[model samples]
Target: MINSSAFQGKKAAYFTLGCKLNFSETSTIGRLLGEMGVVTAAKGEPADICIINTCSVTDMADHKCRQAIHRMVRENKGAFVVVTGCYAQLEPETISRMEGVDLVLGANEKARLIQYLSEAWTDKTDEENGLHRHFSVATKDIKDFAPSCSRGNRTRYFLKVQDGCNYFCTYCTIPYARGFSRNPTIDSLVRQAEQAVAEGGKEIVLTGVNIGDFGVSTGETFVELVKELDKVGGVKRYRISSIEPNLLTDELIDYCASSRAFMPHFHIPLQSGSDAVLKLMHRRYDTALFAHKIRLIKEKMPDAFIGVDVMVGTRGELPEYFEETYRFLESLDVAHLHVFPYSERPGTAALKIPYIVSDREKKLRSKRLLSLSEEKTEAFYARHIGTTAEVLLEKAARGKAMHGFTRNYIRVELPSSQADEALDNQIVTVRLGDFNSDRSALKITL
Candidate 1:
């Protein structure tokens, strides 16, 4: 039990590094703490407690997480530092040894953060070095499902529909850090979505490590879950964060095309477009199946905005393989490409492969893919010019321009002179105008 009085008026700082899933979890944690009478520390104000949620997808991600931990510690001075998420779950000792880190929680222990904080504050001199570490003994033991629906500092909510991944891809460490696939019942998720609607969330993004692998534990299907969410009242829009190609069924695509709230947007991970590289990465689907999924979506919804995840320069990705991937991607009708250079993760099967792409080669490949992405994105936006679309406006800083996203996920901005915070979170019909000055978003006219 926590002494609520002791935490009253206490200020806490939160820092999240990594995916939307991490942000959702961190927001949930903040909400939990808020219930105990703790408030978020304002900028430049030293907090009494600091929580950091980290990611460990790649070597660069890990490096950034470490840097974040150190900077938080320095900024907060004597704040009781707490670290959790994938990186802490994978390497607790490393984070625990960092100065001023008072507690380290893991995947299994995150849900019990309040309880742990209670214990820590109650017994001031409980452990040597003043560090308390609690994590699952192994990845398999991380089975508890922590449901989260939060909209931290944003108009749109992020609902965590599923957690953990069963697919242990060759170049990934997610399965090791997050454990096996698991999810709550569909009814529970629907209730959470309703709760989000009650909290003024008009849009929701379903987030997960392996969303399509949603029913491994519940025996329900992802399509079934989607159907249930579509019926939830007050949610004007919903987007599937990312789904694997093999699990993105035709039935799901068809439902989104005709559903009441589902958006005409999809983010599919096609890590490598080359069949050989896919095989080497132990991906379940081939290039042919991936192309079929893309075609299916386009057939059902012609104006859909499709985004792809492509990794350049992984193990066994010879020059020929890279070219194959580039050519394959060029043939696809995706609107954008999220290109990342492969970083070797420890304790993965990728180490067994001998071929390695040099740093310079990786940069070149990444640059080429990025250029292709820009060309495709510009074309996609150009096609929508002068067209009418409904955009969900977001709150903007005072005296600044307001921005929002269309049903198809196109970002559109309103001029600063005409925009005001009064129109925040309202869906308005606007004519898409020319590209903004930066080309990052399309300007709009009422």
Candidate 2:
């Protein structure tokens, strides 16, 4: 048996790379350690433990994770390093062999972090077990569902309603890394949200690998989950993270349009606009269905902000197909476009495709979509200028201007003179002004 007192006064530095889901999970881990008397290390302070959560979304993401692991190890010398997340689950052997890594936990094993840390601490000085590189990974049939609701250094909380994915898209490795689709019961999630409200959380973002497939584990539906959450008092705002186009039902969209706290912002993934490319990628929906969803959201809520995820230069994306994608995106009335240049993930069906987009062509296509995104975003923000909207102010450093987001997800910034710390986390009414000098956010007048 390990004594809990052994963890007293220890400081841990957390490094998370990848999606919001990773951040939420890391925060939960921090809280678990906090219960054992471990506190987060301050900036520029050397930590006794370093927890690194990694991502494997793309090749570039993997590279960044490696760099983060190395930097954390160097900055916090002699810290007991622990790595977990999608990358650690997929590449345990590689990460375990890293110079400073002491323990590598997989997706399922991360829950037993404190137990493993205790064992490591007891056995660190054994010369026979020199440089202990222990790894606990469960890659096949990942069935565990770890519930997480954390507000890590932010005003809005990230509530992970679901985890894992069942969809096996040709260019994706999420299903392999995160296991199958799973979620907690609606009652459990509602309780979690209520707890967040009690803790002064005004906003929450529902995050998951495949949130729309939330009913697989529990017999409940995603709409049911949303309805229950809306009934939670004191939750001023709720935003659904990226969901598949096919799984976004009309009932859900209409309900959000009239719901109490659900925001008028939707993030839908339209990987490709070309039907041929969609088939090649094994996507569930085509451009027609995607366009219909966008239209329905606008018809129900004209002021709704629709953000799309578009991937360029996937396998078999011929020149004409690329043009088709460009034209289809050009026709959409979306508020923003998240453009990504496809990276070839290993062991996927996309590798077997005959045609491949060159790096130069991929860069070109990505540039075109990004430019279109900027144009659409500018137009979306301009339409709201001179209009009145409620903004939820977030905490800012002393003497720094405060920033927040509107109901439709428009970023608004206050003047530096109004950077009062008292206004942090307060929702206030403001008039949207013209774009700031950088055009990144609109200047607001209270």
Best by TM-score: 1
lDDT of 1 by residue, 79-119 (tens): 77889999999999888888778888888888788888887
**Candidates' C-alpha lDDT:** 0.92, 0.91
Model 1 RMSD in Å is: 1.2
lDDT of 2 at 111: 65
Query: Residue 359 deviation, candidate 2, in Å?
Result: 0.9
Candidate 1: which stretches are off by over 4 Å?
Answer: 124-134
Q: Distance from true position, residue 10, model 2, in Å? A: 0.8
Candidate 2 has which clashing residue pairs, if any?
none
CA displacement after TM-score superposition, residue 353 of candidate 1 (Å): 0.3
